[model samples]
Target: MTDERLIADLHNRWVFGWERNAGDDPFDFRRVFGEFYDFDSPDVRLYDDFDPEQRVATTAAGYGSIWEPGFREMISAHHVVDDGPHVVADLGLAASTLVFVARITLPDATTDIRTTSSLVWRRTPDGWRIVREHNSTKVLPAGALDHRLPARRIT
Candidate 1:
C-alpha cells in the first residue's frame, strides 16, 4: 500500500482502538496505542504538561475531582457524530512522522461536543504508530434543566 494509505489506515485504527478500549478499560494503555509507544516519555505530551502518567494518576484519583471522568469515558466511547475523510497535511519521510487533523463529535450528557484533533504519527518497524494526539473540545449549550430539587442543595 502507498504511504498515504498506510498512514490513513493507521490513524483510523488508532482512533478506533482508543474509543473501544477507553470505554471498557481506561487503564489499558496497550489497547489505546501501539506496543512500541510509551505515553510517559517526554516525546509524548498532552495539553498543559499532562503526560500519560499524569492522566493515569488523575483517573485513579477520582471522578470530577481535578479530573473529569466523563471525558475519559467519552474517549473510550469514541462516538463520532459525523464520519468524514481525514486529510494528510504534511508528511516527513526522513523523520518518519505524519501530521493530520480529524474532526469528530462526541456524545455528552446533555450536549454533543465537537472536537478537532491533531495527531502525529511515526512509522515503526511493526507498522505506523501514533506518537502524539491533541484534542480540543467545543461544548454546546444544554437545552433544558430539571425543575426537580437538587439531590443535595449547596449553601
Candidate 2:
C-alpha cells in the first residue's frame, strides 16, 4: 500500500480504538493493546526500538496512569471538535501521529474545558496499533472570588 494509505489506515484504527475505549463497553487492555502489553508493571513506556517482549509491560504502566477511574470520568463527557485526516506537518511518516482537539462540558458547571491530544501509532501484523498517546487540558478562566466570602467561594 502507498505510504499515505498506510498512514490513513493507522490513524483511523487509532481513533476507532480510542472511541471504543471511551464508550460504555468494558475497557479491555488486552484486546486493544494485543498480548504484548503488560498491565502489572509500574513503568510503561512505548517505543519503536524497545524490546518487543517488554513492550507490554511499559504500555501497561503508561496507560494505567491515564486510564484511571478519575481520568475516564473526566473524559467521558468530552466532545470531539475535530476528527479527520491529520496534516502530518513534521512527523516522518504520514500517520506517525494524530493531533486532535476536543471540548468537555462538565455537568453542572458553566465553564467548558478544552483538551488537545495526540496519538501515535505503529504498524504491526495485526494492523495499525496505537503505540503512544498524550492529552493536555485547558479550562476557561473564571471570575475572581470575593475575599470576604467563605473560602468555598473560590470556584
Candidate 3:
C-alpha cells in the first residue's frame, strides 16, 4: 500500500483506539504505545501549550506515561474535526495534524476542550512509530459544544 494510506491508517487506529476507551476512561497505554511509539528512541517528546514545563518528554516511558491512567478518561465525547488531519510525509518521516474536540465530565462540571495536535512519526523496522507530538488546547465556548463528526470512519 502507499505510504500516505499507511500513515493515515496508523494515525486513525491510534486515535480510534484511544477515543474508544473514553467510555471506561484511562485507555490502556500498552496497546497503542506498543504499536505507535518508538520505544527505543529514548527521546520521545510530547509538547503541549497549556503547560510550558511539559513541553517535551525525552524518554519513551515518560512520554507514554503522560496519557496513562489519568484525568483524560473523563472524556464523555470526542470527535475528529472534519477537513482536518492535514498529513504529509517524505523519506522516512511522517506528520499528521488534526483537530480533536472532546467533552470532559468532571465531578461537578463538564467542559469542552479543543486541541490541535501534530504527531510526528518515523518509519523504522517496527513500522511507523511516533517520535514526537505537539498540541495546543483551548476551552471551547459554551455555545460551540457541538460534538458532531462526519458519518464515515477513517479506520
Candidate 4:
C-alpha cells in the first residue's frame, strides 16, 4: 500500500479506538491505545498542548495514560479528518501530519476541538509503529462543529 494510504489507515484505526470506549466511561484507556505506538523505543515522545511538562512516554500504555483522565467522562464523540494525512517516507521511517476536528460530549457540556498532529513512525518487525507525536489543539466556540460533514460519530 502507498505510504499516504497506510498512514491514513493508521490514523483512522487510532480514532476508532478513541471513540470505541465512549460508552464505557471508566474504560481501560491503556488497552484501547496499546496497538498504536512503539513500546520498545526508549524515547517515544508525546507532546500535547494539555501536557505542559513535556514528558516522554516510553510505552504506548504511558501515552494512553496522559489522555485517560480527559477522556474518562466522554459521553459521545465525532471525529473528522479536516486536512491531509500529508506523508513523507524514507526507507523504514515515515512522518505524517493530520488536522482533525472533534466534537465531544461530557456529562456537563459539549466541546468542539480542532487539532493538528504530526506523528513519526518506524517500520517495526510487527508493523508501522508511532515513535513520536506532537499535537496542538484549540477548543472552538459553541456551535462550531458541523455534523453534516462526513465523520466517525459515536452516540
**How well does each candidate superpose onto the true structure, as a TM-score?**
0.50, 0.46, 0.77, 0.83
lDDT of 2 by residue, 1-155 (tens): 66556666555554445442234555554566553333433443443211222323255555544443433443233233344555342234223434343333223332333444455544445544445544555554542222211121112
Per-residue C-alpha lDDT of model 1 across residues 1-155, encoded as one tens digit per residue = 66766665555555455343323554345434434343334454333112223442212122123234434544323344234335453454212222222222235333324455555555556655445555555553442112221111112
lDDT of 4 at 81: 81
lDDT (C-alpha) at residue 104 in model 1: 21
* Alpha-carbon lDDT, every model: 0.40, 0.41, 0.67, 0.75
After superposition, the stretches of candidate 3 with alpha carbons farther than 4 Å from their true spots are 20-26, 50-55, 72-77, 147-155
| Candidate 1 error regions (>4 Å) | 20-27, 35-42, 48-78, 81-85, 89-111, 143-155
What residue pairs clash in candidate 4, if any at all?
Answer: none
Could you tally the backbone clashes for each prediction? 2, 6, 0, 0
lDDT of 4 by residue, 1-155 (tens): 88667877897677557663355657576576667788778878877784656566667778777777767766666677888788888889899888888777776777788889899988888888888888888999876876533333435
Q: Compare the candidates by lDDT and give the number of the best one.
A: 4
Q: What is the lDDT of candidate 3?
A: 0.67
Root-mean-square deviation of Cα positions for candidate 2 versus the true structure, in angstroms: 10.1
The ten-residue window of minimal lDDT in model 3 covers 146-155
Candidates ranked, most accurate by TM-score first: 4, 3, 1, 2
